[model samples]
Target: MSRVLVTGAASGLGEALSAAFEARGDEVLRTDVSYERGFETGASAPSSTSGGYRLDITSDDDWAAALAHVESTWGGLDVLVNNAGVAGGGRLDVATMDEWQWITEINLFGAVRGTRTFVPMFKRQRSGRIVNTASLAGLVHPAGMASYNASKAAVVALTETTGHELAAYGVTAHVVCPSYFRTSLMSSLRGADTALAEVMSKLVDESPVSADDIAAAVLEGLDRGDELIVPDQAARDAHALKQTDRATYDVVMRAQAVKLEEGAR
Candidate 1:
């Protein structure tokens, strides 16, 4: 019966996560940019014991309004999932400045803002859990996904720091670094290279996981108070490779990037 707030609740991991939490009898407040017709899953934008609302994670005002609602309604918060993110893709040389800004604002700054806004309340209550959804791309550092990888990597750092800061207050932070899965996240992605997109799409389709698996892993991780939750085997292996051999890993990744590009040609 934890009071939970999940961003990007409209679909994919977020939607499935909301339903999962609600099914567990926990109070869930789902929020996103809009609650349109097709957003029925995350479209419950009105604040209730089991409903949601429109919350643009990139806006300070929107964050404040949502927190205000929580103050008046729930009176306190327990879990916050900074799960709202849009995909941005490109190599560092050709990537747009605006694209980097856009991606960071939502993927990184949005999480920072959420945690900043809620920290006071968490301190007051002296108990909270903040879960951030990063990606294997962050750890794997795959080429052509520079923007996405950098932003998600920053999230991991942010959450680790926040966890350290809030541990004294009984507030914990969890980071979920997951590999490809069946999710609506692909719908929000925008790419400049069709070849990269084709390769990623093929790899993702070949991935043996689903959004539900990720959600389930997050829940279990939260329950176990595990700080780092790598949901699937692919993500685990990626993190391990980087851990075991940094220089060799980098060389291999660069070589793979070359091969991927050549294959695309």
Candidate 2:
């Protein structure tokens, strides 16, 4: 069985992926910033932090320690899923630089740290897979998601670069760009942000797919040797729309901004 380490494995897409790998008899090592509050598990309240599996993606020391743990326990790693992410809603006028830093630290740099820490190990192994969980926002930018858009976009770029470099060496890399799913990512956004949350929730509610659907897409992408794995129709369409008919996509995005402005008012 493949040995896999999934960041943010306690909840959402990460949780689903962990289960999927485990079901295949893969050795799954789960890590998150904190397990005490079940933020890792999608619970809204803070609880006591669980030992051993706790990993703050922002910390290099934490990365080293986790790598050490994997080396000591699993002997090696086969897959690294940089899946930890957070959501927040704010534009330039309202969002603080601190907020931007926080999101990038987790969303962008978190993945960076993981890639940097693992690339050498994978290189040594000469066979590995890096699956990064970016977002549709990376391709289809929208208002109230500036930080998220920027961060995930960087993740996409990073994974793409890694793929270009690693493919020659038999290492595989793929970026997972998913649209809204029936996960707690919307609820996990900073502040209440309920109006936007409700908007996202409604979209997912009306959609035909859930986390499991996206997980299946992820595995399919792996099987196909796909570079950019857009898991949902929304993401696939938006990505194509952005590239093919950008003017229409821009107009639609502007309409979304107007709705958000009116809601804030």
The residue ranges of model 1 lying beyond 4 angstroms of the native Cα positions read 36-51, 263-265
Q: What TM value does model 1 have?
A: 0.92
Measured on C-alpha atoms, candidate 1 has an lDDT of 0.84
Error of 2 at 12 (Å): 0.6
Estimate the Cα RMSD of every predicted model relative to the unseen true structure: 3.2, 5.1
TM-score of each: 0.92, 0.88
Give the per-residue Cα lDDT of candidate 1 at 38.
21
TM-score of 2: 0.88
Global lDDT scores for all candidate models:
0.84, 0.81
In model 2, the clashing pairs are 36-47, 36-48, 37-47
91-194 in candidate 1: lDDT tens per residue? Answer: 76657888888889899999999999999999999999999988887677888888999999999999999999999999999898998887777777776666
Candidate 2 positional error at 114, Å? 0.9
